[model samples]
Target chain A: MTSPKDNKSQIWKKDLPKHTFILLVLLLELFPLYMMLQISVKNNVTFNANQWLPITPDKWEWGNFVFGYNLIMPYVANTVFVAVTGTVFTLVFAVFAAYFFARYKMPLSGFLWAVFLLIMLIPGVANIVPLFVLLKNMNLLNTLWALIIVGIAGGQVFAIFILRNFIEDIPKDLFEAAEIDGASHLQQVINVVLPMCAPIIGTLFILEFLGKWNDFLLPLIVLRDQDLFTIGVGLIYLDGEYNKDYGKIMAAFFIASLPLIIIFMFTMKLFVKGLSAGALKG
Target chain B: MAQPISYRKALNEWPLYLLVIPSLVAVLTFSYFPVLSAVYHSFFDWRGGDAKEFIGFDNFTRAFSDEQLRYSFFVIFILVIANVFKMIPSIAVAVLVHRLVSENAQYYYRLLLVLPMIVPGLVTLFIWKFFLDPNFGALNAFLDITGLKTLLIWLDQTFLHWGVFRADAPIAWLSQPKLIIPSLIIWGFPWIGATGVLIFLAGLQSIGTDVYEAAELDGVGPLSKFFYIELPLILTQVRLNLILMVIGTLQGFGLQLLLLGDSGGPEGAGMVPGLWMYNRAFGAGEFGYACAIGLMLFVFILALTWVNNKFIRVQK
Candidate 1:
């Protein structure tokens, strides 16, 4: 907005203080990550010698990554399964619920929509104890299905809320046109709504996926077997074992974060837009 | 808006309910059931099984006098206070990034801020745990390298002595009772949450360029520009983030549970209401008491949110 041609060279100096301050904050923000990467390549001896900085590439030890991979691979798989399954399950339920809410306004339907909206006001913390007991009574304890079921149920409120907004915004003619083409309700949903709300569904999927992935206390309480451990609980156990082996622990940390980072790399644009949208609506 | 259907027509459209039933059933079974059961069970003496006896208000009476539970609230009070200060960095960074002359620089900054978010939150907690390891942790290493350890020792030896920061050993951050709260406070150093910054940035995006130009014409200084223009404009975002953080901190115990154990650090200094509920339920098998605690927290949060809305909304 300023006269850019008048002081083209001054932009750097003008923003120097802001730039320096932001970069300083960024340094602190990224410090732990840098530390994790540095220690991930250093063995015990080298870690002791140079805990201050990363060792040279030639001096780097690669065994930590291999060992970390072998150690946490099962847990990572368990987490990926839970997160993906839960996200899909959440999206499915949410899509159906959202479609009904968006398409109709019968008295009963309106009452039901109010119930769903009120769901947000209920504090989840209060339900933790009873939920645990419910899971227990359902014979769901120590099973990945417990996590998936609970996650799917807990995730419905937000998904339905956001998806309803997206689905309603969609032009009504599309659904009507599909219906005239002899499309059943399900077919209309699949062919018309799904394609139109694909972006929002992607956003919902990523958000719900992250929610399931980072979930700690539920998995910690539900799963008794190390084999059933999600990444969060798995890391806690790994930390207990590898407290001294900073290299392996950091490597495991990196390994656990790999799927999320990869997902983010592909969906960074949607991720940003989604976060902003979430705030605006929230 | 959704189109309206007549009741007679709605009667014929009963099958449409099939689309909504699955999610409704799941939520009712898993979510609503627990909530209703928690309310029902809070008045009974239950051990997380079929055996239960009606205790009326005994659990509530017990929670009112519980020492650890009360102390956990005190601990969270300190944390919530620390978090108010913690929010400053995100706001500042968003403002600074918004002020950047070059759009390209702004994009890179946002990208860099968001990149760290890919590391799951659990991993962040784990890394912070690593960073605070007394022996070889980043904090201690930095202290020693900067000769600040000597300063800490001097402070300990002189008027302000804690005895924990002695010359004989590395500072045990997680173990020391006195340092536990401070350590908790400092867990996410420079706590510029990428999501938080983005939220604030989204708010700042609504500010017009002409506003800044008018301020410049009025000879408004940078600090006043921030205080008078940028901050007030972003107050809604700030208020939203504040409400979220408070509710989050109130319900959160994962950080405490992960860094400090379920017992909540030395002398249980880091214990929070959520963690205490978990400990009581899972640790002591005091399921009834834990439900009471959870209900208590629920009421407390509801009250705080009501207050937040009243306080912030009126100002707006």
Candidate 2:
């Protein structure tokens, strides 16, 4: 009912501060990163001078990125191998487990799900000491397999939780229709549930990727070999050895962070969508 | 009449069970197995290098009676206060971002907010330590320009010698056992803010627009709408954030180590449970005792989380 003239001015005025704060917040958020980047580009001599801004006539020192890559590349590859293999295993197991939980009236299903809820609440640090012993006993210490196995197990609960919710959203009649066609439960899961839950699965994949990629504490304790370090563990090494080399460390951080940033940028909407959906329900 | 089930019926259902086996094995081996072993180890005096020695309740008694343990608990008590201040800024910024008009603008702000989360704790720890260093750090540089000489000696007790440059300053930050808790709080708060924002943003996105529209029609301004409509709706998110922050703050180590060093700084100012457990097991070579301490923390955290869940019932 407002006049067009009044509405136009009101809308414009409301948006200006929001836009300003948005820009301001974004800049403030990036400040630390900017600092990190500044450190990485400068050489030791320049960095020691403690110049916050990079001055003219100094190398960007792109070698820091290369050095970081060479230092952590094997670890990166190892993480990729672990993550991909773990994700494959996690998704496979979660699908069937979530399917069983959702569709079947199995004995103690409720009890089993309650166990998952309990495990989810307990933070990862609580079990580190015992896990170290268990892995030693199993002769899995310093092995990439240990990391993979642990990541897969830890990753499944969240994936299963989300996938179960997503699967429940599929109309029951779809499964009933497949049943009427003489399809087995296995076939029904593969044919109907899997395809419909693709969005949620994809979302879980990114979450798992970011998580395993950046994980530090577990890799620090579990993997003794320098070669098996993930980006996070590798960065820890960089920090220790070149503690004063802010420039190189910053450069290394930028290089290490790029992949995650790119992946997040591309799949952001889906990430938020899946996360909020899960959050809302929980 | 009931017919005997075909063998195929059992086989068909086996895939479902089969699919969950790997996950179960992994969970049992990595998580459940370790947890139970930790409980078992708590009763022994097995150091990392030595044979396991039975200690019964000795380790538990030591952990409870240790003065340093009592001191860290006091630190955590102070930290809980700092957390209250942090929650206010986090919620306000998150709510502000939700009100922004342009999608592109929101994207930039969100990415900016996410920047801190992406900063690895180890790296950020070192960076902040350098900044907070008593000597020749940027923080002191800024303080000097503003005629704030008093802030310099407060950076550390030994630096108070330079208080003459300040007219009269007391080096207090790392040296004072009492102030170190607040110091730790300052270090921990910014790192956690990003995660808080991201979680809150997700919560905010889920709130119904119709509620906001109705509020606007009822002559409510943006600020009032936020307090009445948005805040209540996002209480679940806030509660979730509190649960996470409590667990993380209780367990985290790198920052404390970075600022206070492995000795837990002067007078054990920055000691928390994680560092305490690490020192006992790794430093003092008391693996069994360390495992006991770790187990105690696990039980404490589990109880806290359970209590929080019970107390914070979501409106929905």
Candidate 3:
């Protein structure tokens, strides 16, 4: 009974609140980021005066970025070394375990997989004290090796859980075809499993890399030397040093967060898929 | 014909077992060993050095009796309550974003919502620390610019009569005991947690569209559709997120540690059990007491997780 114009108006009425809500949320989510960007460029004198402004071109001081970058570049490099090595080790161990669990029927496979799940249930903070002592005993304290080993070990359980599901989902025919052609277990994994599990590998790599890069407490506890700090630890040190210098601190914040932001922008789809995949399936 | 592999057959499958060895070794060394050590260390009076004595449940007894540790449990309870309420807005936002008219807009909005996840969590907390600084914080500046500062003072004096604020005084967010918890709650205002949204969205998307159309044909309104369809369907994800959040809040003291430092905030108001464990082991060299605290927390989390699983299964 309603006219086409009336129907159009009703649709608008229904959507108007939804659009408004979304826009408000976008503003709230972006507000601190906008403030960080604005303060990073604003000169110290004008920072308080124009704190609420999105940008101030006339009074901008680009020197903040230069100063912050110089201070944090070494830390960024250290983080990259740690995150990359950690991800590679985690992926290597996790892929092998996942392939074995998915394709091969080894003894006590069910029990082993259950134990991994049980490990996930144990709250991580409970292990911090004991792990600290363990690292200290091995004389690995104050070294990146401590973080790297823990990162790889901690990341593998979740990585294997998700990767096993992904590998199991691969068509059985592909593996059979490879095996019939005389592919050994290792050869079949290399030829069939690795190629089919690329998406998941990419997903776990990004997730684990991001987690290692953002980790604060482990690095703060393990590493004592300023030169060996990760970006998260380095930023805390920067905050203490430049406590009153808002401009410089914000600049450091931007620099510390830049790599992950860049990565997320490029691989956002994979990141989302990874997040949902682990949670939904697990 | 499906028989279990014998020892000889298992030996023949050595390659597969070999592939799992590295992970097994790593888990045993890092994960399992630490837990066992936690249990073993809890019974001793060892500090950092080799001066060890078997205390035999003294650490556990002391932890149970410690007044400060009991206060921390209360603080943790408040934080967990706040966290539960925080999930509501995250779910609402996810549902709203799901109903967006344009597919491109929906994708971009979801991306924008999650963009903050890329920022290091410590940096975000630091930015909030600055934003809540009493003297020159952006929050106060915004209130001043909007004339809300005067309005708030008037309301405080006339209606609420709390007498806590003067017209000229800036609120000390982190320094005051009363305002510390509120400041923690407000730190991530609008609380659009990226993972929560994504999980809920995935749950919603998995529902068939035909159910929605059928509901519409039944003259179901938006509220009815949400309660009757969306709510029940996404309950599994909701339950999962709740369990995760509960576990996370109980185990997490990083934010509290970073914000309050080793002192556990002003008057130890922000002290949670996790931070207490860190302080006991690292700061005070009471490793035995720390281990006891850690074991207790682990058992509590395990019990809570089991109860949650049972409750959710019963609801189904």
Q: Of the candidates shown, which would achieve the greatest TM-score relative to the real structure?
A: 1
Candidate 1 overall Cα lDDT vs. reference?
0.88
Model 3, residue pairs in steric clash: none
Clashing pairs in 1: none
Q: A1-282, model 2: which lDDT tens digit per residue?
A: 999888868866987876676556566555666777777777877776756786564557677777767766676687778778877877887887788777754555667777666678776655777777667777888888887778888887887787777777788889889989999878988999888988777877766766776666677778888877777677666766634666666677776766656766787676555445545434
Model 1: how far is B89 from its true place, Å?
0.1
DockQ of 1: 0.78
Instruction: Compute the lDDT of residue A172 as modeled in candidate 3.
Output: 82
The candidate maximizing lDDT is 1
Each prediction's TM-score versus the true structure? 0.96, 0.86, 0.94
Model 3 ranges off by over 4 Å: A1-10, A180-182, B1-8, B145-164, B207-219, B314-316
Docking class of 1: medium
| TM-score of the second chain in candidate 2 | 0.82
Per-residue lDDT of model 3, residues A1-282, tens digit only? 999888878867877898899789878877888888888987668876667775657667889999889988999999999999999999999988998888755778888888888887778777999999999999999999999999999998988988888888888888779878988878887888789889879988988998888898999999999899998888777766644878888898999888888888789889888887766654
- Which stretch of 10 consecutive residues in model 1 chain B shows the poorest summed lDDT? B307-316
